[model samples]
Target: MNILIKSATLPDGTRADLAIADGVFVESAGSGATVIDADGLQALPGLVDLHTHLREPGFEQSETVLTGSRAAAAGGFTAVFAMANTSPVQDTAGVVEQVWSLGEQHGYVTVRPIGAVTIGLAGERLSEIGAMARSRAAVRVFSDDGKCVHDALLMRRALEYVSTFDGVVAQHAQEPRLTEGAQMNEGPLASELGLAGWPAVAEESIIARDVLLADAVGARLHVCHVSTAGSVEIVRWAKARGIQVTAEVTPHHLLLTEQLASGYDARFKVNPPLRRDEDVAALRAALADGTIDIVATDHAPHPVESKEAAWAEASFGMVGLESALSVVQSAMVDTGLLGWSDVARVLSSAPAAIGRLAGYDTPFAVGAPAHLTLVDPSARSVFSVDHLHGRSVNSPYLGRELPGRVVTTIHRGVPTVLDGVLRDPQEVSRG
Candidate 1:
């Protein structure tokens, strides 16, 4: 459908009439085009999540590619890099291609499958990186996200190998030895609750080592879900030293903190568990100063049975895709640390560049691919499961008042979401 968005606010705070036709942004819309009153809405570049767990090809009970894509679209995302660690793991060319095809067939969001850096994600040896990269899927970002690549030699090899193709090795920086039986952020609260502590050093140490190794190998490295103040300092230092490194902070870590675990609500549970308020403050500062490159959902999902168990036995993840943008609005934009253009940079263009996804650098420009979202920044309401469009209901922000709503999301010139309602899959695919 040709689209004419009237009086939409651009990221730079200017108002304009935006036009989309034939799958690209155009200078004007024809008379037959669909007209959308975008008055009072901010038109942002479609968001790109560098890290997301769609849980398909194996964990469909949690989230299928189609359902996850719908969830992403509802959150104003145009593209999400689905993490490896599936049933067969996206380690081979066949698996990655299958995931890529599923996303295309689903037709809601661009699902770029992340190839596993190790076989079976066992950290035993490297996976078929070259084959997956060369495959039709064209996998570029590689990671064993659920499991950190603890072997320094293997980490070095993975970094060196991806650099040959100008690909990046995204590391889940956690030292295995220090985090045994860890449940939450290591602190007094853990002692009070009798839950095992996940020390900050466990995360910071590995990141420090990996950055040095990346520098030594002269390869690009991206750190996933950095949660500690010290981790931010290390990444900032690395950038100052001219190391090829980029880091991301999850929305949960930005607005929520370890105190939420006081009641043992497993919904608060996540890998690289929530940190102190000081950590959150530092993370916001780093992002504002451009030390943190982007915000990723790390949108892990699980069945009701998985999270309803005892805190110690429950799964460690929170479904974040549906609530990510609102959280960013509350934590960053409302706080006056960032403007809408910066939000576009962190949530869209930067992540797209890091994942090597093209066509996003010049967002909303005429002739550019028409992947964009319209947001009502004045909307404020308590978040609920009704806001979630995925198969899972594991979000942590339920009942919390959030500041923004994604009124419309256009993917490749198709309206996946319109007037705050997610379109049906059939209708979306037909477009």
Candidate 2:
């Protein structure tokens, strides 16, 4: 396979043609080589998702590795770190290996499985983290997502346990005590709506405790979906104190607020819940000034029936893979808080570095993996379900107008998406 992307803006502020051969990027092409005009599009490093629940190995009705990877490709992602909170939980070497192998079988993008922090994500005991890490899957990021590892002593032990192998625990920071029976952010909105109060302190306290614990244990800590301004303050303080803690704010948290859920729709019900506009501004500033290291889509996919229920009865997530970049481009780029390089850094590079993945986040140069996203920022678009590739139509941004469509996405020099359409996986896979 060979392609010459003509006259695209490179990350280094130069416009040049990128030539690819057999899925590995070759040098610039000579005159009259088989080429596709980028029409002066801004070529970017392919996006990476640090947190995504593919829902395969269980809950196939919601998604499979095939459909999820297809969704990822359509979303301009070259790789996604699959969350371990599956049916059985990716707590063992066998399960992680199976998920990894299935990703290869699909051959659309890299699907790295996260290992559960405790048995079955129960938080009862330390999972076989070392064993899972030692497997062919080489799981490095462990999490008890969808459930916080709230036991202080156990969390301390888990933090120390992963340190021996350079593993980092990605915690879903919420104090079970504070969030017990809670549905939305604790505020007047909850009072008016007659919903349970999931307080900001629920998130802040866990982040504070984990930061202290990480400081005490000298291990790395990652706060998943840091929502509240209080939580942001904690992360900001931790980083200033050199506490070795990093935080990520989802695209929803950066854009939407509790007001969206006033409709009482299930799609707006996400864990850590949508926060206030001030927190959203703070998070965007944090991303700009390096307070938040990555902007990952907590791309949780829920089945239609599960999400289409009453707000409280429905699942606490929304499919984000397909809409993440557009949301960022609309909310961040359109607002002047971020540039194209900053976009790549947060969406592609920083997340890969934090998640400890392989072969992603590379600069576009000779000998680098040819993962790329060709963007048409001038392209006006709408979030139509007909254009969505994910099995679940649970994205919160449906019917919203947005900018920056991904016209072409190349994974390892092969076009998984050409002209904004998902190509046949078999045609793109390396033989």
Q: Best-fitting candidate, measured by TM-score? A: 1
lDDT of 1 by residue, 44-141 (tens): 99999999999999999999999999999999999999999899999999999999999998889999999999999999899999999999999999
Cα shift from native, residue 360, model 1 (Å): 0.3
Candidate 2 local lDDT, residue 176:
89
lDDT of 1 at 64: 96
lDDT assessment of candidate 1 = 0.95
**Backbone clash numbers for all candidates listed:** 0, 0
In Å, residue 179's CA in model 1 sits off its true spot by: 0.3
* Per-residue alpha-carbon lDDT of candidate 2 for residues 197-276, written as tens digits (9 for 90 to 100): 88898888889999999999999999999898888888989998999898898999989999987999989999989988
**What Cα-based lDDT does every candidate model obtain?**
0.95, 0.87
- lDDT score, candidate 1, position 28: 89
Clashes of 2: 0
